[model samples]
Target: MPIPIELSLHRHSRVLEIAYEDGTRFKLPCEYLRVYSPSADVQGHSPDERVLQVGKEQVGIDKIEPIGHYAVCLHFDDEHNTGIYSWEYLYRLGNEYEARWNAYLDELKQAGHVRKTLDA
Candidate 1:
C-alpha cells in the first residue's frame, strides 16, 4: 500500500517532519531531502549524469505546495523549485540517507569541496 505523508516544517532544525499513513515518522533535514529529490530535473536519467548542487549550506524550504494528493512541490530559498517530492521517494530517501549521505560526503571530498566541521 502506498503511504501518504503529512509533512510539517520544523523551522528551528530546518527539517521536514513527516508522518505516514502507516504511522512511520521521519524528520528529514531540508538539505538532505533537497539533495535527494527524485525529480528528473535533479536525478536526471543516469547516475553519472547527476549534477552537483553546491552552496546549499544555508538553503531551506520556503514553502511546500500540494500537488494533488501524491506529492508536495517544495520551493527552496536557493530558488530550486523543479523537484516534486512524492511520498514514496521521500520514504526511500529517508531509508537510504545514511549510505547516500556518506557517498555524497565522499564525492564532495573527491571534488575538493569542503564541508565545515561543526563544534557539536
Candidate 2:
C-alpha cells in the first residue's frame, strides 16, 4: 500500500494536503473527508446503512492522531473523530475524489439538500 510522506491541514482553506511516497499528492477538502469518513458512524456496517452527511461544507480538521504505522484518526471540528483513515483508504480517496464527490453531490440532491456555496 502506498504510504503518505506528509499531511498538512490548511485551516483557512479547509483542505488537507497529503503527499504520498509514490510522488502523488491530493488536496482533499475537509468537507469531503468528513462526509466520506471510514468510521462505522459515517460508513455504517453495511453499504445500505451508510449515513449521508450534510451541512458539513464548512467543517475543518482539529487534529490528526496517528495510529501506529497504518492509519490516522481525524478529529473534525464538528466533533466527528471516529474515523480511522488508513494509508490505502486515504490514497483511494484521493485517487477517486472526482467520482466520489460527484456521487455525494448527487446523493445530496436526491435527498433534497441544497449545498451552500462558500465564498472564495
Among these predictions, the greatest TM-score belongs to: 2
Where model 2 places Cα greater than 4 Å from the true spot, the runs are: none
User: How much lDDT does each candidate structure score?
Assistant: 0.78, 0.96
Q: List the residue pairs that clash in candidate 2.
A: none
Candidate 1 ranges beyond 4 A from true positions: 117-120
**Predicted structure 2: lDDT:** 0.96
Provide C-alpha RMSD values for all models, in order: 2.0, 1.1
lDDT of 2 by residue, 21-75 (tens): 9899999999999999999999999999999999998899999999999999999
- Supply the TM-score for candidate 2: 0.98
Estimated TM-score for each candidate: 0.88, 0.98
TM-score of 1: 0.88
* lDDT (10s digit) by residue, model 1, range 1-120: 457557889866789888888888878888777777776777888987787665565668999998887788988877888898877788877778789888878877888888754322
